[model samples]
Target: MGWYGQVKTNRQLQVRCNYLNGTVNKYLRPIGGITIVADIEQMKISEYIDRAVIPLPKAEGTDYRASTITPPFGPRFNAAPPKPRGQTGFKLDGNVVSWANWKFHLAFDARVGPVISLASIYDAKKKSYRQVMYRSYISELFVLYQDPTEGWYRTMLFDSGEFGLGNFAVSLEPLNDCPSGAVFVDGYYAASDGKPVQVQDAMCIFERHSGDVMWRHSDVEREIRETRPDISIVVRMVSTVANYDYILDWEFKPSGSIKFLIGLTGVLQVKAVPYTNTDQIKEEVYGTLVAGNTIGISHDHFLTYHLDLDIDGDANSFMKTRLITKRVKDKNIPRKSYWNVEHEIAKTESDAKIQIGLNPPELLVVNPNKETKLGNNVGYRLVPGSAARPLLTIDDFPQIRAAFTNNNVWVTPYNKSEKWAGGRFVDRSRGDDTLAVWTEKNRRIENKDIVMWYTVGFHHVTCQEDFPVMPTLSVGFELKPTNFFEYSPVLKTVPPQHLSWANCTK
Candidate 1:
């Protein structure tokens, strides 16, 4: 039964059978539907016996199918011929990439998919390559559906762990998925039976020019103009986990920035509805009615990333440059107010835990010992993209199990056993070995070899456009150079020449 705006609204029916006990007992059957009537702190289960279980209308009806009887008949149509463009600029020496004075080793992992190692950038002033991040990868992703029905109550899925990421990688669609001139890489993994299988073209590497200026200077007095075009190399991989497809990209910039991006697309897992139109629904439905008898449920996606940043050979400290409004204290000025910067150095694990807000402080990981030419600490600032913190309450079961998502950012001293945010085997894990459990020790992180963990999430509210298939939803974060460089890294790089602008007549 659907929720009718009741306080105890979750209607999760428990389907009891012999399959759960690993025995075939024909006498076993379902007892009753269990409804969660309590708050998120203490979930109280109540048996719902009066409601009748009825089969919903199927979506294969004629009104729901796309019609081919229109004037534009369904047939193959030619769009344009493929103009082959050759690859240049980037040179790959067997999994090692060397571009823009940045060198790193990219390897495919069976669980995490792509693990980047030995990332370093060439420092012009030092005349040597400086180590940035030693290794970084996506730790885990926890997705939970909003529906409180028995079928979806325990829908907490550990996508990367439960099903190996490399096992689900699909072949790239040459020009459609990735741009032309992209180099494809194959992935190999072991199956459940211990037999090795390979997926061809599982990842693609390419360089793209978005026509953005990296740096610009125009001196009217000197009659000189200079501008450098922005160019980047992206390592792309797509994995299909059951009904949803995830597109992950590791983008490298010439300006010394590493961007981690994720895109969610694919068919939606919809529920069968009974109403055909708005007039048929007397009460509020829990989801959106995409078709005649289909309801796309609401859900949330939370992804945790493990970053082992070694800025100038580890021994780094986390600092928060907080900006606060300051009223003018000078009587001579007669001004109203201004903002002031207050620097806060994190001394402990608890001090480093961050909860993002409208105007959060500038988070930076810096080596206090290493100074730039300006005498400032060499560091990299974390720039977040479109992301959300987990909305699930801290005391909830799924929240406790995935406690790493409680805060937006967390820094801890490097520990080998603390890889997965939800523990090693998270198929149906409890809250025992989670990140929250590890942070309880309150270890010191200041000026130590530390690891940073950030959670990026999205609270999805279903709409009509997300009916049968959903458009790609992307969210990510970037690690950009901050005082680590005395000036722009691409200041001396050459810029591409612009071509003649085309008119309508061609």
Candidate 2:
């Protein structure tokens, strides 16, 4: 047995032998499973160590054959017919995409992979294109493994900075990673020798329908029924960083909502363990032993985003609209309590540092000069998806390297030098040039051109199902129009209907 958890004891099993040029040493045993002697001279283990004594987990009668497992016998389970071919509803003009009055220019960066810029939506009443987001892209990815050994302590990987995400992007497989009717786009990145290299089919764009209804209502009294189907245009890219593959999708809905999602699916980084059964273990293991000799360690993934929202124009303000509970002060009123909305504008950079709370506030970027038909400020709401906060404290080594994850959200005055959240070159950075450092000046941000940074975090705990290859785990965020549009953007639209087998037979 080998060292399992964080223990101070030096109980290790290393069988050193003079085989194959005398450099063979294998620590194949766990200390918790077997007993060891205090003094090495007292035990005669040196005699057996003359030859290589390390053995495989399967050779020791432990069953770790994941590929040989068979499924249970059952009847045929085909329950539905083949889906009909889907038609495209969006138009592509070079890199600019247009669908349902939504237009955006898609560009690729060597580090960030996909960049969306010049995003605008058409207004039905005004019949003009209104600006929403000027530019947006993934700022950085902080990945750290939780092993403190000599070989595993410094295993920190920055997917974007260390190795260019666009450079390592592989051609997506049709009908597998993306749909059959996707439009593939090429990308380019600079080589180490300062020459530009082309990446073929680095991104795919397509329209998706998930059989979901956007809105529907039925009024039996008035004999009126209405329904609207949900449809979206998606831009996807998958970047394989070492052993992990990250799939990023940007979904644009007709209702003026942009959803940014990231999915992780790949092999787990496993370490060698010795124990085969739980009863044989006396001490605690830091990670779960999925196989007989393999232990998958815990880890965390934090993806920070750079968003420059031009709600109506370049000049905008950040505000937190909170729902506060109020007590009825008038004794004549029968109601005891009520709720009211409170908006607080962020005047300085420090005022915009937000930690997600149980009672979260709505983060909005509004143009102070513009107003909607209802006299409300034109704005877009920053809606967070299923995410977790970075659990590491600020002083930790890993946290120091990625200080941008200190807050879930941060707003700063727009600067061209402040693109990457971690730094420009994050291979072995010392945390000097980070987003947290720039926000320390506490510059004025009220009604000024600003950038909003948000981090989507994940805390992973390995299980048996994550052995050979892990299933995809997803996290995302959304930018939805609150009062930027006068009313429902998809109110006056007609969608196509699908004919079922029963309906076609009749």
Predicted model with the maximum lDDT: 2
Candidate 2 off by > 4 Å: 1-87, 332-335, 497-506
The TM-score of candidate 1 is: 0.84
Reference-based TM-score, model 2: 0.83
Candidate 1 ranges with C-alpha deviation above 4 Å:
1-86, 217-224, 282-284, 497-506
What is candidate 1's local distance difference test score? Answer: 0.76
Which consecutive 10 residues in model 1 have the weakest lDDT in total?
22-31
lDDT of 1 at 499: 58
- Candidate 2 lDDT: 0.77
- Deviation (Å) of 255 in candidate 1: 0.7
